[model samples]
Target: MQETIKKIFTENIQVQIAAGEVLPSALESAAFTIAQSLINGNKLLCCGTPSCHMLAQHMAGLLINFYETERPCLPAVALAQEQVNLGAIANNDEHETFARQIRAFAQQGDLLLAIAVNGNEKQIISAVEAALTRDMKVIVLVGDDGGELVGLLGPNDVEIRVPSKRPSRIVESHLVNLHCLSELIDLTLFPQEEN
Candidate 1:
């Protein structure tokens, strides 16, 4: 059991190191986008699959509540958290669930944060398209070479592709990145606060 624990930590560290090399610029970009949206009085919308959905909600909660400091709550919503809306959409057009929610909630200049491990899911792609149609900025955290999600990104959109193919490694890296982004957003919005 001890060996297994150590092995997990070692592998996680390796993946995180690789992600550190490739993801900083993208993370910075995402933070800037999120901050700018908030500055402009725009909200953030987040969505993903079940596993990634938790991360999406986690980020929205951090922004809408507080990260590590006592600051004003930023506007953020996790589309996946709308149980009734999701169920209604699922009953009608399942693949369009997120896309429909995005259309209803997102406005121009708002930011959409989409999390995906494989990045090829149909609903994720549709959500990206919907965000684009609504003139919202998009930040996608994806794994395994970004899958089809890479092809859908526009020039202004940002994609943070985790370097590993394994889902566990990808998710671990995403959590770290999400926390880093929250800290950055907090600092960028309230630089006067003591660190």
Candidate 2:
């Protein structure tokens, strides 16, 4: 049992380190891109698979409320829960649920931040496709070779593929990635004014 726990911890750290080596520049680009979109008065739309959806909501909350410290709320919305709560998801096609919301809410220059813990997140890919048609920039955090989602991204989009095959490690790394992105966005948007 102890060995299993230690393996998990070690694997998580190793994945993060591998990600840290390759992802910094991509992270910076993504953060700056997100910040620029917000600066242009465009909102952020987030969605993910069921488990990853919670991370999407967390990112939206951090942006729309506060990340680490108090700051003016930023504009963001997590798409799936509202549909589920309103009972729309059941009525609408499950695959198009997020894509439908994106068409309804997104505008040109808006951003979509999507997290997919594995390569099999079909709905997330659908949402990415929808967002693209509306001219929204996209950032996807995916793992396990990025699946079909990788094939879909255009030159303008960003895909932060986690450096891990384990779903747990992928999800954990994604959380850390979200926090880093949120902090970077805050820093970019609200640099402390010199007294």
Candidate 3:
């Protein structure tokens, strides 16, 4: 059992390190994109699959509350955090749950930040499409080769793809990536004075 635990840790670290090598620029771009939208007085809309649902909300909380340092609340909404009535709009469809919300809440220059345990989440793909129709920029956090999602991104969007094929490792990398993005956004939007 101890060996299994250690193996998990080792693999997690290896995946993170590998992702670190290729994902920095994408993370930075996503941070800047988010900051720029906020600067333009646009809010962020987030959604994801069940596996990534908390992560979507976590990103929203980081922005609306604070990443680390206390700052003014930023405009961010997690679309599915407490949507008890999504069924009415979604009609049992996955992405429609988010797509309906995105169409109603999203505006030009706003941003949609979506997370996927893998690239083939039909819900996320549909949500991304909906956001595009609303003229919102997208930043997708996906694992593996971005599956069908690789073709969905537009010129101004960013895709932070974790290199690992393991779902657990991808999720862990995503959590860390969110933290980094939040930190960069804070630095960009509310720079601290260097002592």
Put down candidate 1 lDDT per residue, 76-96, tens digits, no spaces: 999863447465547776768
TM-scores vs. true structure, each candidate: 0.93, 0.93, 0.95
Better of 1 and 3 by TM-score: 3
The digit string of per-residue lDDT tens for model 3 on 1-195 reads 999999999999999889889999999899999999999999999887889989999999999999889999999999874456765655556557788888877889999999998789888888999999987899999998898886999889999999988999999999999999999999999999999
The lDDT of each candidate is 0.89, 0.88, 0.90
Q: What is the lDDT of residue 123 in candidate 3?
A: 84
Rank by lDDT (best first): 3, 1, 2
What 10-residue stretch in candidate 3 is worst by lDDT?
81-90
> Which wins on TM-score, candidate 2 or candidate 3?
3
Better of 1 and 3 by lDDT: 3
Error of 3 at 143 (Å): 0.3
Q: Give candidate 1's error at residue 183 in angstroms.
A: 0.7
Candidate 3 displacement at residue 18 in angstroms: 0.7
Clashing pairs in 2: none
